[model samples]
Target: MALRIPKAELPLEVRENMVQQLGAVPENVEVTWHSPKVAQDDMEFGGEVGAWDAADASLKSFAQMAVPALVG
Candidate 1:
């Protein structure tokens, strides 16, 4: 059987998209916080800060959804 994933563990954009498309996540779904630090770290050494900026943008979009904790 397939295990359901948590909405919070998903990328903010992905969670937003899911909310837009599926209305809601099922009750059995697990959840976790999405840390922006992780996003920044992944992009910090990419020769420039563009990746980090993009990650921030994603977090901003998530903030609009009232899920600011998604950023950490």
Candidate 2:
């Protein structure tokens, strides 16, 4: 049997904070953990943008994901 390791290790402070807020460290977040400052700012910016309620969430989710999938 083989064991898998994380791509990047997160700082304990950041990891615990993520766990508290999000239940677990999400895979997408692992990329930003390399720069803890970016990770923190991303979280803050995400909090700000994520609170908007003017759009239908399902369409917002679809557009958010779909365009990335269609990029050149």
TM-scores for every predicted model:
0.26, 0.56
**Top candidate (lDDT):** 2
In candidate 2, stretches whose alpha carbon ends up further than 4 angstroms from where it belongs are 1-6, 55-72
Per-residue lDDT value at 36 in model 2: 70
Tell me the number of clashing residue pairs for each predicted model.
1, 0
Q: What tens digits encode model 1's per-residue C-alpha lDDT throughout 1-72?
A: 554653346566756865786696433332323454654454345437544444556777666877656655
Candidate 2 global lDDT? 0.79
Looking at model 1, residue 67 earns an lDDT score of: 63
- Please give the CA lDDT of all the candidate structures: 0.52, 0.79
Q: What shift in Å separates residue 54 of candidate 1 from its native position after superposition?
A: 43
